[model samples]
Target: MKILQRKRKRIAAVLFTLTLMLCSCGQHAKTEQKHDWKAEAETASVYCVGKDDCFLCGTDAGYFGQNNIGIVSLNSFAVMPVEINRYDHNGQLIEENTGAMQMENFQNGENGMTVSVMLEPDRGIAHISISPNGDATLDLASAASHLCCDCLAELVSQLYGSVNGIGVVNFSTRRLYVLQEGVTSFGAGDYYVHCDYEALGGEIKILVIYSSLRYENLK
Candidate 1:
Protein backbone atom coordinates (compact mmCIF):
# COMPACT_ATOMS: atom_id res chain seq x y z
CA MET A 1 0.00 0.00 0.00
CA LYS A 2 2.84 2.41 0.86
CA ILE A 3 4.60 1.72 -2.45
CA LEU A 4 1.40 2.31 -4.39
CA GLN A 5 0.81 5.66 -2.62
CA ARG A 6 4.36 6.81 -3.46
CA LYS A 7 3.90 5.94 -7.11
CA ARG A 8 0.59 7.80 -7.25
CA LYS A 9 2.17 10.92 -5.73
CA ARG A 10 5.05 10.87 -8.22
CA ILE A 11 2.65 10.50 -11.13
CA ALA A 12 0.58 13.44 -9.89
CA ALA A 13 3.66 15.63 -9.60
CA VAL A 14 4.77 14.80 -13.12
CA LEU A 15 1.30 15.55 -14.45
CA PHE A 16 1.32 18.93 -12.73
CA THR A 17 4.70 19.78 -14.22
CA LEU A 18 3.58 18.82 -17.66
CA THR A 19 0.42 20.90 -17.29
CA LEU A 20 2.49 23.94 -16.32
CA MET A 21 4.77 23.49 -19.29
CA LEU A 22 1.82 23.19 -21.64
CA CYS A 23 0.21 26.30 -20.23
CA SER A 24 3.41 28.30 -20.59
CA CYS A 25 3.82 27.19 -24.18
CA GLY A 26 0.21 28.02 -24.96
CA GLN A 27 0.57 31.53 -23.55
CA HIS A 28 3.71 32.12 -25.54
CA ALA A 29 2.06 30.95 -28.73
CA LYS A 30 -0.93 33.18 -28.14
CA THR A 31 1.28 36.18 -27.68
CA GLU A 32 3.12 35.42 -30.90
CA GLN A 33 -0.08 34.87 -32.84
CA LYS A 34 -1.39 38.26 -31.77
CA HIS A 35 1.66 40.17 -32.93
CA ASP A 36 2.03 41.34 -36.54
CA TRP A 37 5.67 40.72 -37.43
CA LYS A 38 5.28 41.30 -41.17
CA ALA A 39 3.62 44.63 -40.57
CA GLU A 40 6.33 45.62 -38.12
CA ALA A 41 9.11 44.69 -40.54
CA GLU A 42 7.48 46.67 -43.33
CA THR A 43 6.95 49.72 -41.14
CA ALA A 44 10.48 49.51 -39.82
CA SER A 45 11.86 49.29 -43.35
CA VAL A 46 9.95 52.39 -44.41
CA TYR A 47 11.04 54.28 -41.33
CA CYS A 48 14.66 53.30 -41.84
CA VAL A 49 14.62 54.70 -45.36
CA GLY A 50 12.70 57.85 -44.51
CA LYS A 51 14.43 58.67 -41.24
CA ASP A 52 17.33 61.09 -41.13
CA ASP A 53 20.83 59.64 -41.05
CA CYS A 54 22.42 59.17 -37.62
CA PHE A 55 26.07 59.18 -36.60
CA LEU A 56 28.33 57.08 -34.36
CA CYS A 57 31.48 58.71 -33.01
CA GLY A 58 34.43 56.50 -32.22
CA THR A 59 37.16 57.29 -29.67
CA ASP A 60 40.02 57.04 -32.11
CA ALA A 61 40.75 59.03 -35.27
CA GLY A 62 40.82 57.59 -38.76
CA TYR A 63 41.34 61.13 -40.00
CA PHE A 64 43.27 64.22 -38.93
CA GLY A 65 42.63 64.76 -35.19
CA GLN A 66 38.93 63.90 -35.37
CA ASN A 67 36.94 60.95 -34.14
CA ASN A 68 35.79 58.63 -36.91
CA ILE A 69 32.07 58.91 -37.63
CA GLY A 70 29.85 55.96 -38.51
CA ILE A 71 26.71 56.61 -40.57
CA VAL A 72 23.97 54.30 -39.35
CA SER A 73 20.87 52.94 -41.08
CA LEU A 74 18.53 49.95 -40.82
CA ASN A 75 18.15 47.48 -43.67
CA SER A 76 15.03 45.73 -44.98
CA PHE A 77 15.26 43.03 -42.30
CA ALA A 78 15.77 45.68 -39.59
CA VAL A 79 19.46 44.87 -39.20
CA MET A 80 22.11 47.59 -39.27
CA PRO A 81 24.73 47.34 -42.01
CA VAL A 82 28.09 46.11 -40.74
CA GLU A 83 30.20 48.03 -43.26
CA ILE A 84 30.54 51.69 -42.22
CA ASN A 85 32.64 54.32 -43.90
CA ARG A 86 34.90 56.62 -41.99
CA TYR A 87 35.21 59.94 -43.78
CA ASP A 88 38.23 62.19 -43.48
CA HIS A 89 38.15 65.98 -43.18
CA ASN A 90 38.50 66.36 -46.95
CA GLY A 91 35.50 64.00 -47.48
CA GLN A 92 37.62 61.03 -48.51
CA LEU A 93 36.06 57.78 -47.26
CA ILE A 94 37.64 54.63 -45.86
CA GLU A 95 35.39 51.64 -45.38
CA GLU A 96 35.82 49.35 -42.40
CA ASN A 97 33.71 46.68 -40.77
CA THR A 98 33.68 47.83 -37.12
CA GLY A 99 32.51 44.36 -36.01
CA ALA A 100 30.10 46.10 -33.68
CA MET A 101 27.08 44.02 -32.80
CA GLN A 102 24.13 44.78 -35.03
CA MET A 103 20.90 46.12 -33.61
CA GLU A 104 17.31 45.94 -34.84
CA ASN A 105 15.04 48.87 -35.79
CA PHE A 106 17.45 51.39 -34.29
CA GLN A 107 17.02 55.06 -35.20
CA ASN A 108 18.44 58.48 -34.58
CA GLY A 109 17.72 60.33 -31.39
CA GLU A 110 17.92 64.04 -30.55
CA ASN A 111 20.33 65.95 -32.80
CA GLY A 112 20.55 62.85 -35.03
CA MET A 113 22.48 60.74 -32.52
CA THR A 114 22.41 57.02 -33.37
CA VAL A 115 22.39 55.55 -29.84
CA SER A 116 20.30 58.03 -27.89
CA VAL A 117 16.55 58.32 -28.45
CA MET A 118 14.69 61.29 -27.05
CA LEU A 119 11.00 60.54 -26.88
CA GLU A 120 10.38 63.94 -25.28
CA PRO A 121 13.52 65.97 -24.89
CA ASP A 122 12.02 68.79 -22.95
CA ARG A 123 10.65 66.47 -20.31
CA GLY A 124 13.81 64.38 -20.49
CA ILE A 125 13.80 60.87 -21.93
CA ALA A 126 12.61 58.26 -19.45
CA HIS A 127 15.54 56.02 -18.61
CA ILE A 128 17.19 53.77 -16.06
CA SER A 129 20.65 55.16 -15.70
CA ILE A 130 23.15 52.32 -15.20
CA SER A 131 26.67 53.75 -15.08
CA PRO A 132 27.52 55.86 -12.05
CA ASN A 133 29.10 58.51 -14.28
CA GLY A 134 25.72 58.93 -15.98
CA ASP A 135 27.09 57.89 -19.38
CA ALA A 136 25.00 54.73 -19.82
CA THR A 137 21.25 55.38 -19.78
CA LEU A 138 18.60 52.89 -20.78
CA ASP A 139 15.63 54.52 -22.50
CA LEU A 140 12.44 53.11 -21.00
CA ALA A 141 9.75 54.52 -23.26
CA SER A 142 10.46 53.67 -26.90
CA ALA A 143 7.78 51.33 -28.21
CA ALA A 144 8.55 50.44 -31.79
CA SER A 145 12.35 50.59 -31.62
CA HIS A 146 14.37 47.58 -30.49
CA LEU A 147 17.87 46.10 -30.17
CA CYS A 148 19.68 43.25 -28.45
CA CYS A 149 20.07 43.66 -24.69
CA ASP A 150 23.15 41.45 -24.57
CA CYS A 151 24.86 43.62 -27.16
CA LEU A 152 24.09 46.71 -25.15
CA ALA A 153 25.42 45.11 -21.97
CA GLU A 154 28.57 43.99 -23.74
CA LEU A 155 29.18 47.58 -24.74
CA VAL A 156 28.43 48.78 -21.22
CA SER A 157 30.83 46.30 -19.68
CA GLN A 158 33.49 47.67 -21.98
CA LEU A 159 32.90 51.16 -20.61
CA TYR A 160 34.23 50.36 -17.11
CA GLY A 161 37.55 49.29 -18.53
CA SER A 162 40.37 51.46 -19.89
CA VAL A 163 38.57 51.80 -23.21
CA ASN A 164 37.09 55.21 -24.01
CA GLY A 165 33.40 54.55 -24.67
CA ILE A 166 29.80 55.05 -23.52
CA GLY A 167 26.65 52.93 -23.97
CA VAL A 168 22.85 53.14 -23.61
CA VAL A 169 19.84 50.85 -24.04
CA ASN A 170 16.16 51.65 -24.77
CA PHE A 171 13.46 49.18 -23.83
CA SER A 172 9.80 49.15 -22.88
CA THR A 173 8.10 47.80 -19.76
CA ARG A 174 4.66 48.01 -21.28
CA ARG A 175 3.02 44.60 -21.15
CA LEU A 176 1.43 44.76 -24.56
CA TYR A 177 4.30 46.03 -26.67
CA VAL A 178 6.31 42.99 -27.73
CA LEU A 179 9.76 43.94 -29.07
CA GLN A 180 10.23 41.02 -31.45
CA GLU A 181 6.87 39.38 -32.11
CA GLY A 182 7.58 35.79 -31.09
CA VAL A 183 10.59 36.39 -28.83
CA THR A 184 10.20 35.97 -25.08
CA SER A 185 10.49 39.17 -23.04
CA PHE A 186 11.33 38.05 -19.51
CA GLY A 187 15.03 37.24 -19.83
CA ALA A 188 16.12 40.80 -20.68
CA GLY A 189 16.98 41.55 -17.06
CA ASP A 190 20.07 39.36 -17.25
CA TYR A 191 22.05 42.45 -18.29
CA TYR A 192 20.89 45.03 -15.74
CA VAL A 193 17.97 44.75 -13.42
CA HIS A 194 16.92 48.35 -13.93
CA CYS A 195 17.32 48.15 -17.71
CA ASP A 196 14.94 45.25 -17.94
CA TYR A 197 14.71 43.93 -21.50
CA GLU A 198 11.06 43.18 -20.79
CA ALA A 199 10.64 46.88 -20.20
CA LEU A 200 11.22 47.22 -23.93
CA GLY A 201 9.36 44.08 -24.92
CA GLY A 202 12.58 42.07 -25.03
CA GLU A 203 14.28 44.77 -27.11
CA ILE A 204 17.22 47.01 -26.25
CA LYS A 205 18.69 50.18 -27.74
CA ILE A 206 22.32 51.22 -27.57
CA LEU A 207 24.40 54.39 -27.69
CA VAL A 208 28.20 54.28 -27.60
CA ILE A 209 30.57 57.23 -27.84
CA TYR A 210 34.31 56.81 -28.12
CA SER A 211 36.64 59.57 -26.92
CA SER A 212 39.21 61.14 -29.23
CA LEU A 213 42.17 60.12 -27.06
CA ARG A 214 43.78 58.28 -29.96
CA TYR A 215 43.72 61.20 -32.38
CA GLU A 216 47.53 61.39 -32.47
CA ASN A 217 47.74 57.96 -34.15
CA LEU A 218 46.09 59.30 -37.31
CA LYS A 219 48.65 62.10 -37.71
Candidate 2:
Protein backbone atom coordinates (compact mmCIF):
# COMPACT_ATOMS: atom_id res chain seq x y z
CA MET A 1 0.00 0.00 0.00
CA LYS A 2 2.88 2.37 0.79
CA ILE A 3 4.47 1.72 -2.57
CA LEU A 4 1.16 2.34 -4.30
CA GLN A 5 0.78 5.60 -2.39
CA ARG A 6 4.25 6.70 -3.43
CA LYS A 7 3.52 5.98 -7.08
CA ARG A 8 0.27 7.86 -6.84
CA LYS A 9 2.02 10.80 -5.32
CA ARG A 10 4.53 10.86 -8.13
CA ILE A 11 1.80 10.65 -10.69
CA ALA A 12 -0.09 13.46 -9.03
CA ALA A 13 2.97 15.64 -9.04
CA VAL A 14 3.52 14.99 -12.72
CA LEU A 15 -0.07 15.76 -13.51
CA PHE A 16 0.11 19.01 -11.61
CA THR A 17 3.18 20.11 -13.51
CA LEU A 18 1.64 19.19 -16.80
CA THR A 19 -1.49 21.11 -15.90
CA LEU A 20 0.46 24.24 -15.17
CA MET A 21 2.38 24.04 -18.43
CA LEU A 22 -0.78 23.49 -20.41
CA CYS A 23 -2.45 26.43 -18.71
CA SER A 24 0.51 28.69 -19.30
CA CYS A 25 0.79 27.68 -22.93
CA GLY A 26 -2.90 28.15 -23.54
CA GLN A 27 -2.91 31.58 -21.98
CA HIS A 28 0.17 32.54 -24.00
CA ALA A 29 -1.43 31.48 -27.26
CA LYS A 30 -4.49 33.55 -26.61
CA THR A 31 -2.27 36.49 -25.75
CA GLU A 32 -0.33 36.20 -29.01
CA GLN A 33 -3.40 36.05 -31.19
CA LYS A 34 -4.85 39.10 -29.44
CA HIS A 35 -1.82 41.31 -30.00
CA ASP A 36 -0.75 42.64 -33.38
CA TRP A 37 2.90 41.64 -33.75
CA LYS A 38 3.70 43.79 -36.76
CA ALA A 39 2.24 46.85 -35.08
CA GLU A 40 4.19 46.12 -31.97
CA ALA A 41 7.41 45.76 -33.94
CA GLU A 42 6.84 49.03 -35.76
CA THR A 43 6.11 50.84 -32.55
CA ALA A 44 9.24 49.45 -30.93
CA SER A 45 11.32 50.38 -33.94
CA VAL A 46 10.04 53.95 -34.14
CA TYR A 47 10.73 54.59 -30.46
CA CYS A 48 14.36 53.50 -30.62
CA VAL A 49 15.14 55.18 -33.93
CA GLY A 50 14.64 58.55 -32.25
CA LYS A 51 17.07 57.73 -29.41
CA ASP A 52 20.88 57.55 -29.44
CA ASP A 53 22.69 54.63 -31.02
CA CYS A 54 25.04 52.70 -28.75
CA PHE A 55 25.41 48.93 -29.19
CA LEU A 56 28.39 48.53 -26.86
CA CYS A 57 26.59 49.52 -23.67
CA GLY A 58 24.13 46.71 -22.92
CA THR A 59 26.13 43.52 -22.42
CA ASP A 60 28.26 43.57 -19.22
CA ALA A 61 29.55 47.02 -20.09
CA GLY A 62 31.93 47.66 -17.18
CA TYR A 63 34.88 45.92 -18.82
CA PHE A 64 34.77 48.48 -21.62
CA GLY A 65 36.86 51.68 -21.77
CA GLN A 66 36.09 55.15 -23.11
CA ASN A 67 37.62 54.48 -26.51
CA ASN A 68 35.91 51.12 -26.75
CA ILE A 69 32.41 50.85 -28.08
CA GLY A 70 30.33 47.74 -27.23
CA ILE A 71 29.29 44.72 -29.31
CA VAL A 72 25.86 43.25 -30.14
CA SER A 73 24.84 39.64 -30.56
CA LEU A 74 21.92 37.49 -31.62
CA ASN A 75 20.16 35.05 -29.33
CA SER A 76 21.73 32.26 -31.39
CA PHE A 77 24.43 31.88 -34.06
CA ALA A 78 21.90 30.79 -36.69
CA VAL A 79 21.76 34.39 -37.82
CA MET A 80 19.89 34.96 -41.04
CA PRO A 81 21.13 37.90 -43.11
CA VAL A 82 17.69 39.50 -43.49
CA GLU A 83 17.40 39.79 -39.74
CA ILE A 84 19.87 42.68 -39.38
CA ASN A 85 19.94 46.28 -40.48
CA ARG A 86 22.42 49.12 -40.40
CA TYR A 87 21.42 52.73 -39.78
CA ASP A 88 23.50 55.86 -40.23
CA HIS A 89 23.73 58.40 -37.41
CA ASN A 90 21.09 60.32 -39.34
CA GLY A 91 18.71 57.38 -38.80
CA GLN A 92 18.83 56.69 -42.51
CA LEU A 93 18.74 53.03 -43.41
CA ILE A 94 22.29 52.19 -44.38
CA GLU A 95 21.19 48.66 -45.16
CA GLU A 96 18.40 46.42 -43.86
CA ASN A 97 17.21 42.89 -43.90
CA THR A 98 13.91 41.34 -42.91
CA GLY A 99 15.00 41.69 -39.31
CA ALA A 100 16.72 44.72 -37.74
CA MET A 101 18.30 45.72 -34.42
CA GLN A 102 18.42 49.29 -33.19
CA MET A 103 20.07 50.62 -30.01
CA GLU A 104 18.90 53.71 -28.22
CA ASN A 105 18.30 55.51 -24.88
CA PHE A 106 21.98 55.76 -23.94
CA GLN A 107 21.92 58.26 -21.09
CA ASN A 108 23.28 58.67 -17.57
CA GLY A 109 21.20 58.02 -14.48
CA GLU A 110 21.86 57.72 -10.77
CA ASN A 111 22.53 54.00 -11.00
CA GLY A 112 23.74 53.94 -14.61
CA MET A 113 22.37 54.59 -18.05
CA THR A 114 19.08 53.25 -19.40
CA VAL A 115 19.66 51.00 -22.44
CA SER A 116 16.73 50.72 -24.77
CA VAL A 117 16.78 48.69 -27.96
CA MET A 118 14.97 46.22 -30.26
CA LEU A 119 15.94 42.84 -31.74
CA GLU A 120 14.57 41.46 -34.93
CA PRO A 121 13.88 37.85 -35.87
CA ASP A 122 11.81 38.20 -32.66
CA ARG A 123 11.32 41.95 -32.74
CA GLY A 124 11.12 42.42 -28.97
CA ILE A 125 11.97 45.80 -27.49
CA ALA A 126 13.58 46.09 -24.06
CA HIS A 127 14.37 49.14 -21.95
CA ILE A 128 16.81 48.27 -19.19
CA SER A 129 19.02 50.14 -16.73
CA ILE A 130 22.65 49.40 -15.98
CA SER A 131 24.67 50.94 -13.16
CA PRO A 132 28.01 52.62 -13.69
CA ASN A 133 29.30 49.68 -11.70
CA GLY A 134 27.81 47.20 -14.28
CA ASP A 135 24.76 46.02 -12.37
CA ALA A 136 21.74 45.23 -14.57
CA THR A 137 18.03 45.75 -13.97
CA LEU A 138 14.79 46.50 -15.79
CA ASP A 139 11.94 48.85 -14.99
CA LEU A 140 8.22 49.00 -15.75
CA ALA A 141 8.92 50.81 -19.02
CA SER A 142 10.95 47.86 -20.23
CA ALA A 143 8.89 45.63 -22.50
CA ALA A 144 9.22 42.74 -24.96
CA SER A 145 6.67 43.05 -27.68
CA HIS A 146 6.24 40.79 -30.73
CA LEU A 147 7.48 37.68 -28.96
CA CYS A 148 6.43 34.21 -30.16
CA CYS A 149 4.92 31.35 -28.17
CA ASP A 150 7.80 28.89 -28.52
CA CYS A 151 10.31 31.56 -27.56
CA LEU A 152 8.17 32.55 -24.60
CA ALA A 153 8.11 29.03 -23.18
CA GLU A 154 11.79 28.48 -23.89
CA LEU A 155 12.72 31.72 -22.18
CA VAL A 156 10.60 30.76 -19.19
CA SER A 157 12.32 27.40 -18.91
CA GLN A 158 15.73 29.07 -18.80
CA LEU A 159 14.80 30.56 -15.42
CA TYR A 160 14.89 27.29 -13.49
CA GLY A 161 11.94 25.92 -15.44
CA SER A 162 9.42 27.32 -13.01
CA VAL A 163 5.81 27.52 -14.14
CA ASN A 164 4.67 29.76 -11.32
CA GLY A 165 4.41 32.75 -13.56
CA ILE A 166 7.46 34.37 -15.15
CA GLY A 167 9.75 35.70 -12.41
CA VAL A 168 13.36 36.16 -11.26
CA VAL A 169 15.89 33.63 -12.51
CA ASN A 170 19.50 33.61 -11.38
CA PHE A 171 22.39 31.89 -13.10
CA SER A 172 24.85 33.57 -10.76
CA THR A 173 27.86 31.64 -11.93
CA ARG A 174 27.12 32.74 -15.48
CA ARG A 175 26.67 36.22 -14.02
CA LEU A 176 23.24 36.22 -15.59
CA TYR A 177 19.80 36.85 -14.19
CA VAL A 178 16.62 37.54 -15.98
CA LEU A 179 12.98 38.61 -15.56
CA GLN A 180 13.44 39.78 -11.98
CA GLU A 181 12.85 42.68 -9.63
CA GLY A 182 15.27 44.91 -7.66
CA VAL A 183 18.38 43.02 -8.88
CA THR A 184 21.80 43.48 -7.23
CA SER A 185 24.10 41.12 -9.12
CA PHE A 186 27.92 41.05 -9.34
CA GLY A 187 28.46 39.09 -12.58
CA ALA A 188 27.75 36.01 -14.73
CA GLY A 189 29.36 33.87 -17.51
CA ASP A 190 26.55 33.94 -20.10
CA TYR A 191 23.32 35.67 -21.14
CA TYR A 192 20.76 33.37 -19.57
CA VAL A 193 17.73 35.51 -19.06
CA HIS A 194 16.77 37.49 -22.14
CA CYS A 195 13.51 39.20 -21.29
CA ASP A 196 11.57 41.10 -18.65
CA TYR A 197 8.25 39.46 -17.81
CA GLU A 198 5.25 41.56 -18.55
CA ALA A 199 1.72 40.24 -18.05
CA LEU A 200 -0.72 41.00 -20.79
CA GLY A 201 -4.21 39.52 -20.96
CA GLY A 202 -3.14 36.52 -18.91
CA GLU A 203 0.03 35.92 -20.93
CA ILE A 204 3.61 36.96 -20.10
CA LYS A 205 6.02 38.94 -22.24
CA ILE A 206 9.74 39.26 -21.55
CA LEU A 207 11.79 42.46 -21.88
CA VAL A 208 15.52 41.90 -21.66
CA ILE A 209 18.96 43.60 -21.62
CA TYR A 210 22.31 41.89 -22.21
CA SER A 211 24.94 42.32 -19.48
CA SER A 212 27.54 40.83 -21.81
CA LEU A 213 28.13 40.88 -25.55
CA ARG A 214 27.26 37.22 -25.92
CA TYR A 215 24.12 36.51 -27.93
CA GLU A 216 21.89 34.30 -25.82
CA ASN A 217 19.62 31.60 -27.16
CA LEU A 218 16.43 33.07 -25.73
CA LYS A 219 14.51 30.73 -28.03
Global lDDT scores for all candidate models:
0.30, 0.33
Q: TM-score: which candidate is best?
A: 1
Residue range 47-89, candidate 2, lDDT tens digits: 2311122222133323222111121111210101111223445
TM-score of each: 0.25, 0.20
Model 1 residue 114 distance off true place after TM-score fit, in angstroms:
9.8
For every candidate structure, what is the RMSD over all alpha carbons to the true structure, in angstroms? Answer: 15.9, 17.7
lDDT of 1 by residue, 68-101 (tens): 2221221111212211224445855544544444
Worst 10 residues of 1 by lDDT: 169-178
Off by over 4 Å in 1: 2-10, 26-35, 41-88, 93-219
Candidate 2 runs further than 4 Å off: 36-219
Decoy 2 TM-score against native: 0.20
Worst 10 residues of 2 by lDDT: 74-83
